[model samples]
Target: MSDTVDETASGAATDPVLQRLSTLDRFLPIWIGVAMAVGLLLGRLVDGLDDALAAVEVGSVSLPIAIGLLIMMYPVLARVRYDELGHVTSDTRMLGASILLNWVLGPALMFALAWLLLPDLPEYRTGLIIVGLARCIAMVLIWNDLACGDREAAAILVAINAVFQILAFAFLGYFYLQVLPGWLGLEQTALDVSVWGIAKSVLVFLGIPLLAGFLTRTLGERARGRDWYESTFLPRIGPAALYGLLFTIVLLFALQGDTITSQPLDVARIAVPLLAYFVLMWGGAMLLTRALGFDYPRATAVSFTAAGNNFELAIAVAIGVFGVTSGQALAGVVGPLIEVPALVGLVYVSLWARRFFRDAPSTDPAVPDTGATR
Candidate 1:
């Protein structure tokens, strides 16, 4: 980690959080916009990458998405210090808030919003809902880390939510579409959620990387010096992950660029529900953290718990389950389009709101004082 990152991770006010926010504020939009353009251009250059993507699979899982998720996840795992998990877990308030916001509240709110707003667009409705239910597992950690959240709290929440999402993703899809009429579709809904299939993919995409991260951390402690790992390996994770993400984005947009080019209107339509979802999630999280008396890091974790979406997992699952041709797949693709920008915005909001809770009493400076846990 850089000196800037160390300060932010240490919870100092004059850390990378402010600088990152400032840099991202100035550069992210341009880079993301450039990403969109270059992605489209590069995406077009390789006409059959999407079709080639179809062949790269492990059993029922898609290879591209699996690889992408792994690349996206491992870097995050590299950043996690399991020691922090113990320290952060001791502060129950932050932990409790993180769990509730991510597992329970985030999915429910997303399902409800997608149901209410997406019905009119028959082609895209289910996809939108699926994307919504698949609340962010990895990027939330990234954003939380960026915002100077309690690392342990964020990691625990990430680990727990990831476990649940794998087990529940397919069931949630079935229930929301076929089983639960109020949340989304009615009797006419005929969507199939492959619980086992999703679980397997989760294993490959989430479980493997997480296990690898744990092993690396454990082994690195005894086999290698902490200084060597942090100094040589940790610093590289940020750029490598960023590169992987951009590459993944390029491939995804390339796969969907034709569709996007043909239907410019779809962008606006998808943006509406996504925007609303982010806004509602942010406001709800802020209120919940405040009402719960969460201190800074914990509240920020809760805020990101709601704010981020695992578009990578969602897209992969959508494609595997619904077929690439379905609108659900399209919705999953649309997720990153909206999410990248929205998360950046949420990061800003979390940082700006830091002053409000900075001095509030808490058990640990590392952990926030959300009332429920601590």
Candidate 2:
């Protein structure tokens, strides 16, 4: 329930956004890199480390991985202000754009890219589609905040996406992996996964954490107050999400280190499509919202929301559905790895693009103008 993290980020930016990050959050890529190295070394040097880690299992998930997955997701989900779902629902323009961009365009774009770019690599392709389907719940808030986007709007969009994900991710997984591929004459996933199977995994992994987060926020706020529950409590637990992410990454990479290290080109191959997806998604979202006359903050919020993926859930589902050594899990791990820097660059792009919006002068880190859009 309590832990501390040194928030960190890459590079030196005198911008307040960069300064706001703690050493831990700032150095996320570095941390993941180190974890990858440690895992690879462990896997390479220690004969039975992977086996030992995988030996203990619960409900088909290795105990260590299960712990990491839950710890990784719970805090992030708890931070989402689920009760505030109504706050931005009234903004039809913004909401519509986000819905189209996130649920429709976002996943479709990833599916196209994965298949088009890595047709020969079904594992990576399926993994990319899973990454796309997971959508952004936890990380988009940070990216939006970093870009000085709307807080309430970010929360609402993230909350909405999380709710839809529990129902839609599996169906989308089934569609992209099975139905769509078959229609396109592409080779489907080797594993015969079903919608219910994916749904069950989603329920256990995302549903448990989602419900736990809801109850925690509700009870914590009722017991204390909003300020204590958020300001006092959330920060302590928040760091564990990344820490848990790193823990799982280490184990996952450990299991597949030989493959990852031997075929460095595979990571590169995975990275190219991902890089294109982020840039295209973010840039396209920004332009679309701007064309729709959204203010800078709203545009930034919507753009980041559209661009980021829920890699935690994606990794969980990939490993759950495809097994740890599967390339799908490896591809899932590469998501946030590439996303971190890509979105950071887009933050600068967002800040720079402010001039294109009429509300450029209103770009302030606050709750945003809550006037209900007529």
Candidate 3:
């Protein structure tokens, strides 16, 4: 196990892709804080900008945020080798574990934490639940690649999570938010969660970008050749997603600056449960990987996929289900604020964890462990 970790670490020390993570990527948390500060300043100085941006909406989705999210998702999806999705059927253990973690455990954990921590703040509790139910499909790819995880497995898990989210997100959300609260004898305001509304947000936020990414990769590879497409074109386009992420953060904070400034304690209260959720989920996923005896790459992939949340989808849903100005929406905006830094730190932890796991054994005959970093 120690030798496998040593080799992976040594390989990572020289890996060009890992080394190329820019200053922006390394200090993403700092940049996010700067964005928040800038947004607050702009909100105070440039009165009516947030109102004007908020006016541009389509079916409850904010136009600027929708655009930012689409750009943020495209590069990550484009990197997926869709041809390798066939491998999903062979790795049933990994798939099953992901389903259990993402669908069952993740939401339940958030539900408990939100109720326990923010009992007086129902809107924030709902927002936390929304975030918990929406499993990650996009940024997990970036984190997986950065940590030298099994890219193919990461891609498959992402695809699986996307499908499950579309089918179950609405139903699960309805149950947790409306039905479960009633069942638990809590006085909760009834929320009209339309399945079609959830589906529409999923389609716009995920489905469209997914199709665009597929077409771009397919056409680009055929035109420029796979080597050039992978080596040159991808590197050029990949950072666009991170740029979009930062831009989106600034917009969100700017829009909510008044609320954030007035009720700073509410933001802190919302943040506490979110912080606990991330730490607990990451720790649990790591333990699960170790117990299952997954190799370094696969373990890292599973750990990240399990821990990360789809903040974009969560934000969209919060706006759609609740109003754009609702506390729920504000809480959704805070999700990525906390997630970006927490996951980035976890990336380093995952890299360090590789040294403790045994080399991927040749036991899984159906899907041979390739141990290929790329």
Candidate 4:
């Protein structure tokens, strides 16, 4: 009976159908969108999402909040191969380029775009800048891997961004608050709770995952091969993490659904600056990568690093500090709506650009000529 049970389990685990489903697991970004659409549709049909959010709470924890943190951790932990840490120091140039673009150029462009275009909507303007300062802690690594980036380079860049954002984001938040016109009183209020609260959220969201990842590698090394650790275990966690995250997005959207519905004008209010930020950063990264003579993978990494925001962390922090009723929280909720789809498009663009750099490509190759003789 034991033998039969083991056989059944193994067969299920190795099923070809399951392997195919695993591909879907990798595309969590798409699932995230689906979750959002479904949640919004549900919220619309029902009265409001507030009760749903309230129902999801457990003690100090909410299911949505738990899911958000999980999503951030799983991606980072899965991609972090401790053996590859040695490679980071070697690929300093690519890492340097990513840091310069994501930290310096990305934040600066976002600040300018928000400042210039969103002066009227101070809360959302602050939210937009928060999105910018946070950088791409999780998604850019996925982009790097998809684009066939040097993993070492990508890891180094992610680690650096994670650390710097804690410090830089607080300062950037203060800076944005200070510069906004005195007429925008929301800035002063946001400035009051901003830095310290964000600092704590950073600690909870990033610190725990990082430590867990490191410890998991250290302990698991003796018991299992790295392939088993990654392919067998990490793959299982990927889908779960993404689903959790999207569910969180749903709750967040639901929480703000009524306000969003009532104030349709807010959509138009925030759209301009968000659209402008996306275009400017994407264009700037592509141009800068070209100027620096980076290959396709490195270029793709840079472009995404600049383009993507740490929306998971942003939403979690925004909700925690700014009330769920606040426009800042609403803006954080809106971020992934644009970000997920835009990134999928950017992934395709990166794949398309791959052909320019080399004769043979890893993902998809150009068709070879065939005679009509067949």
lDDT of 2 by residue, 138-243 (tens): 5566567546577668767776786678677767777878888799887776444455654555466566777898899999999999988877677667667667
Please estimate how well model 1 matches the true structure, expressed as its whole-model Cα lDDT.
0.66
lDDT of 2: 0.73
- Model 3's alpha-carbon lDDT is 0.75
The lDDT for every candidate, in the order shown, is 0.66, 0.73, 0.75, 0.61
Q: Please give the lDDT score at residue 290 for candidate 3.
A: 82
Q: Tell me, what's the RMSD of every candidate?
A: 5.6, 7.0, 5.0, 9.5
Model 3 scores worst on lDDT over the 10 consecutive residues at 364-373
Query: What is the lDDT ranking, best to worst?
Result: 3, 2, 1, 4
The model with the greater lDDT, 3 or 4, is 3
* Full-model lDDT, candidate 4: 0.61
Highest-scoring model, TM-score: 3
- lDDT per residue for candidate 1 within 1-374, as digits (tens), equals 21433334356655534553434333555666677777666556767765676576753444675566567667667667787677766777766776677667777777677767776776577777777667666667656765667655666776667777777776767776667775433644566666666566556766787888888878877777787776556655655555556566666677677666666687678778888888788778887888877777777777787677777667776776778777777777778888877876776677677766745334334321111111
Q: Which TM-score value belongs to model 3?
A: 0.84
- Estimate the TM-score for candidate 2: 0.72
lDDT of 3 by residue, 260-368 (tens): 7777788889999998998898889888988988777788778889889988778778877788778898788778767877887887777667667777544222121
Error of 1 at 77 (Å): 1.6
Regions of candidate 1 where Cα sits further than 4 Å from its true position: 1-17, 20-26, 58-65, 182-188, 359-374
* C-alpha RMSD in Å of predicted model 3 compared with the true structure: 5.0
By TM-score rank, best first, the candidates go 3, 1, 4, 2
TM-score of every model? 0.83, 0.72, 0.84, 0.74
